[model samples]
Target: MIVSRSPVGEIATALAANGLILRGGFNFCDDEAAPAAGSAAPAKSVLLVGQAGAAPWPHFQRWLERQSARIVNPLDTWSCEVIGAVAQEFGARAVSPSDRPYLPFQQWAMRAEGVKPSPLGILMHPQYGLWHAYRGALLFEEEVSLPEAHAANHLCDTCVERPCLKSCPVDAYSGQGFAHEACLDHVRGPRGAPCRSGGCLDRSACPYGAEYRYPADVQAFHMAAFAAL
Candidate 1:
């Protein structure tokens, strides 16, 4: 027996080849979505591509090893290559989180997935916890049929301890907000060796979805990038 293929399934296959997942999507015609770039004729839908946990780390590492020269923002560059190919194949536009004039990715994610922010400001996933990220998106000129997004219970709401709020040595996160400078300074200082080698203490402290937490190496890479910024 053979199963018929669908546009969504085909796209998901392409992304999965590179260890990316279609987080979710929404049609611009849905009214709640902000109009696409072109006013006269805008893209009708968006499919977000991202990773859960360290699923993409091995794939990204292999791609990184093949680069002839040092590449800046290597992960982002690779995401564009992979997602751009799929976009071209589907006649869609590819956009990145790093794009200037910053697309409202967070807003779009909430609309598409019904996810809420964790204490660290990263959107919390019911299953993935703090262990996921939005790599890029595919914007189609015509509407695509997509299943409706269901709201998941917010993980933080039920937790009583709230370890993420108390783990940071500098108290970088609080009711006020993240202290960017403080967090940065600590990650770059002598005492920050643990965090630099592992990951953000506050982030790792989150007890929810411990199994989905990123590996130390993956976390270290991101920490280094953050410290450099």
Candidate 2:
């Protein structure tokens, strides 16, 4: 398609139409190059693609099922396939978080979105909170014009109650840090039912983005993935 808008704008709109959103993005100046091979120069900019709510779950699930017949790692494969195709169309390169030594997506998200780490350790978006994710990105060899990142309120700052800090029965997340072993043990044990079946109590307790919370089965998928790991 002949996109009259800037490349970033075009890419963002294209992704939204495909069940994804251009959640956040950043540009790499010549001095601070992106980490990628072959070009000795990284893409001029990186654009993140992901869903912010359950609205895209059904579409993603259908896409996943269609690929189950041929791809071994469906989610990763699907991300790569969609992003790769879009990159090719836009004269860019596709990359994903699954890549080894991953692309520091969390770090990039913070910088590009002007967000900060919450008590939960993940970046707390004022709108999506803990319910969103960074799926993949596109890197262009040439600079792609993009809107400047703006300062945003760190949601946790104004959250006086901080329900996420106290909701976990096992105290899995706190200012001290996450108790990974304790969390895993609890989730796999008999008393883990609430967390295992409904998702983490702590995550659900967050006041932000309740409207964007993942559906039960979607949360169940993540819980199962964590359990499997």
How do the predictions measure up, each by TM-score? 0.93, 0.90
TM-score of predicted structure 2: 0.90
Question: What local lDDT does model 1 show for residue 90?
Answer: 74
How does each model score on lDDT? 0.86, 0.78
lDDT of 1 at 25: 91
**Could you give candidate 2's per-residue lDDT for residues 1-229 as a string of tens digits?**
2224567777777776667888767778678847762266666777778778765677668887766366556666767777777878887777889998767888788878888888988778888888888888887666556678987798888889988978888999876789998999999998988888889888999989898998888887778778863
lDDT string, candidate 1, 1-229, tens digits: 1113337888999889889999999877555545453234577888899988888888889999999999879989999999999988977788999999799899889989999998889898998888899999988767778889988779999989999999999999999999999888888888899899899999999987789888888899999888884
lDDT of 2 at 195: 83
All-Cα superposition RMSD per candidate: 3.5, 3.0
Cα lDDT for residue 11, candidate 2: 79
Error of 1 at 128 (Å): 0.7
Best by lDDT: 1
